[model samples]
Target: MADLAQSAERFRVIARGKLADPRIQSAIDSSTDRLRSHRVDAWDELGEVEERRSRAYEIRMRAIRDIDGNLERFRTALEARGGHVAVCATAEEANAYVVDVCKRHGAKLVAKSKSMATEEIGLNEALEAAGVTSVETDLGEYVLQLENEHPVHIVAPAIEKTKEDVARIFSKEEGVEVPPVLEEVTASARRQLRQVFFDADVGVTGANFVVAETGTVVTVTNEGNGRLVASLPKVHVVITGIERVVERLDDLPHLLSLLGRSATGQRLTSYTHLVTGPRREGEEDGPEEIHVVFLENGRRNLLDTKYEEMLACIRCGSCLNVCPVYRKTAGEAYGPVYSGPMGAVLTPLLVGIDQAPSLPHASSLCGACTEACPVKIPLHELLLELRRDLVDEHETSWFERLGFSLWSFAWSTTFGYRLSSALARFGHRWASRFGPGRVWASDRELPAFAKKRFRDSR
Candidate 1:
């Protein structure tokens, strides 16, 4: 937030590119509509959406409240199963663990499934710096990897790219010419990754949930890449946030139901893998070794706080789909790995609120994210909490503070509110005199305020 001019220029470039994409509206409408519809159908079929929501929220709350105990128990359980566990307090520590493990294993080529935690830690960049070839196996991730861009959406990383854009990327890569059909694009990618996965020395992934009870990691994905990434390489590493660990194995189905409904609108994803420990002595299909790294980064500080419930998010992008600001600005404007309302709240919190001062203010406090969240995170309330942090933590600039203070006093005083309302109404009347409801409004109007203040009418 302090380094203003440079950050502003970066965001301006992102905004211009996103706003210029004519297909953005259609892209959002098509995917969000399908996702929302799928959620409705899935929940209705389940016949106890409310019941599941209640239980899921409670389960997450209980786990996060006793996060330390749960994490310790998880560590013990995972260790007991012959798996090694590492708890990292920062992204640097997590990256160190991965690089050390890869270097120890002499991993020259690495294949990875889609992992937000890896992105959060800039793992690929770190691995590349350490001379490891990290490949993105998930179709969408592969697209972004090819184009050299960050994911624009969660769940659907390449949502911003149309078929033609994808074709351009692949066509250039392959040095071939043809229509950029989805299946064709997929085939080309498959051909490219087939050898990489076959030859990789290590496979890395992110876990959706870590079941402490079973010492297992769960990953749900539509693509089969998660399975390949987990099973093929000699060593498999699962990177995830500490709060993704739920208390009981029984809570999985309830969360799985919500994740599918919220993420892709399916009752279930095509592939749901539950891997416990490394491969057993006789198992031929799974990896020979397994490692789980629970990353705290900054989550322990949120314990018992207002935002603790955000841990229950399950990483579904339902909130993103409905966020108007996210719709307009796209994910790059968030200036972090996470995007949309959740990103707006999470990026600042996990990274450092001071570095991303504008993120919390990007929202309109519309409460759409809260409503759309399958597990019911109060996203708007979280936004307010982040905003309050800026002031309470003294993260605000003098100019912005003065502006907000003036605004707060104006809206708080009845006399000031009334006067301002009258003046705004009068100004609108004067401006509208140019035509009948023909004011030069692009997105909204300077609608007249109430004819009289509420106190007067009452």
Candidate 2:
């Protein structure tokens, strides 16, 4: 795994490099712009969008509040339907369980849909280490898999890769001339992946929402690949965060409504599978063995804390689409499986704030992510809380601590405050004469201090 600390330290430099690349900028700009516009249209179509968002938020909150009870109910309901549920408290245990399942099924070729939970636990790397061949069935995931690259976006994994880049990847992998046209490229990928699906002994997927009422694992996808991965293989494994499970079946529609619009701007995904359990005696098509692994990798830690609201996130990439910083740096710069605003709050909390110190400060506190969030997570406020935690722990630099200390002390004293303001005015005037030469001032011009103090004018 990449060292998140090292990656975060170099964030500014990496962002600068990515911003300099016209290809990266163009791809990110166009994709995010289109998604944002579609989301606007989709919300407009759904009359009472805010009301829906509030209802979604309430459902998620209620479910999480009684998470343990919900999980127990979900397990019992799923078991009654002949499905196996494994509650893993750690990533290592989750990966071990999946590997064990694969080994028991004698799985060689494993087809997978786009699963961030699996990525969170490094399941692909674990499977390969255990001598299992895991192939990503999602087109974006397949492209990244072939290139040995991580996802650049949550919903659209290969969002940063251009058609030319994909063509080159295909030509190198398949030993054939592949065109850069979108339709041809997609057809070619489908042709290649169809064989993998046929040969797959086990299929792995992530649930968008798990219904406790019916013991159904719900998955939504634009492509038919998610359906194929779940049904075609003899064995199916679902790895998802515990927060994904909702209490009632009816709660699904509210979340679905939010998820589709917030994620890809569709009223509903092309395919939505509600897998209750393994195939029964009379079943025509389905997996013989269905294993659902509910992963609680640091999620349980946030249950009653100030950060519990983070779990309300539905993994809709809407937050990322509107994040100013994410638009430029993309996902890789965060050095974690999850990225963008959600990642900034999540990765640090999961991996340890010390490991990803710069993540909390990466945002501009513009609240775009808060606005974009389907469940109204208040991501910016959470980020601010994390920053405060860092300061409380004395994790920040001495200079920063001292600067803030001085500011606080000055504000407490009227004379000190007035003197500090006068000094700031004089300094700004003096600095304006030399032009903005500091690195921080490269793109921004420092505003000149007010000609006369407010108090003086009064």
Candidate 3:
């Protein structure tokens, strides 16, 4: 987390390091390509995909526009169901509330489903520091937890890990030879986590969408671990961003339609858990108590702002699967929980521009992410907006500012443009050997200018 707050220099260095790792690159390529293909096939089969996307966009944007009202309604409805609601303004506040809950319950072990909000708040570390054992129940997350590594992708945390790597990690942990087979490794993880489910004192998860109308926290999972995490434990805690709340229970199917197809290419995830509240009087296995933590953490600040459309994002990770930069550098280069085009725009906004200035410039402005987004966020446009905001704040370096200023001036008039083009044609070879050009040309070849200009030939 400390590293996430460092300067752009760290991003550059880490990106360079990631670019050099062929093994990691291979893993990322395989996972992203497969996911991308799955999404295409799923959308094709679902017919009227564009209409569904439009409806999803409408649902999300409308919900975000009325976020305050929706949040209040959600609080009221959930509280009416005997659930506890804690609205936290910061990560520290959220963590403290969850920790307090754990302490009140004398909780020694916590089982968690996949939740980026928890990752954003460093919940596991906080719990460990408090002498509470927090285990990730999702298989991919469980693997990354064993390695003490963060998720590389939103849906597939261990996307960069191969079967051999999992076998090695599991074998090392269990003190037995685990085969590098998917079935065997999955069984091994299931065997280990099955006990944790029953023994865990508290269950924690992140809401994919919180229905304000019904006070239901919707979690979409393929592995069904989320169901166990929400039900088996005595106490259940949900931590999520305020933007997740929607105005109606009827809005779910429309949103889920896009989320499922875009995220994993399934019509719907295997387990779409709709938990309204804790156990009822006759319920045999559900949690005795439920707590919902609504984390602001800079999300509300985007309302009525240019970046507010960002809140409409359903976190499908479709942008990552198609992002050229992310496919190459992967998530670690972007730093912490979020990554890819969505992260590039959202991270700096959440953490502040100065904290992650490089993220805004990480994209190629290719617009693939915008096209791929389930809710149509115009992610590339947002990246451009962030870059403009960077210049407005003078956060960019003097050299970059000066260079862009010169380029803008040179290209403003035909005479200046012609003069600059002539100089570039004649001096490109020399320029490629120096300063920024040297760094840019280190891996890519500099194309020679043509002997005859198109204008002159015409």
Candidate achieving the largest TM-score: 3
Candidate-wise lDDT, in order: 0.82, 0.89, 0.91
Of candidates 3 and 2, the better by lDDT: 3
Candidate 2, residues 104-173, lDDT tens digits: the string is 9888889999999998888998899999999999999999999888887889999998899998888788
Candidate 1, poorest ten consecutive residues by summed lDDT: 1-10
Best by lDDT: 3
RMSD of each: 3.9, 2.0, 1.1
When sorted by TM-score, best at the front, the candidate numbers are 3, 2, 1
Model 3 scores worst on lDDT over the 10 consecutive residues at 1-10
TM-score of each: 0.90, 0.96, 0.98
Considering lDDT, which of the candidate structures 1 and 3 is the better prediction for this target? Answer: 3
**Sorted by lDDT, highest first, which candidate order results?**
3, 2, 1
Instruction: Give the TM-score comparing model 3 with the true structure, all chains together.
Output: 0.98
Between candidates 1 and 2, the one scoring higher on TM-score is 2
Model 1: residue 327 alpha-carbon error in angstroms: 1.9
| Angstrom error at residue 220, model 1 | 1.1
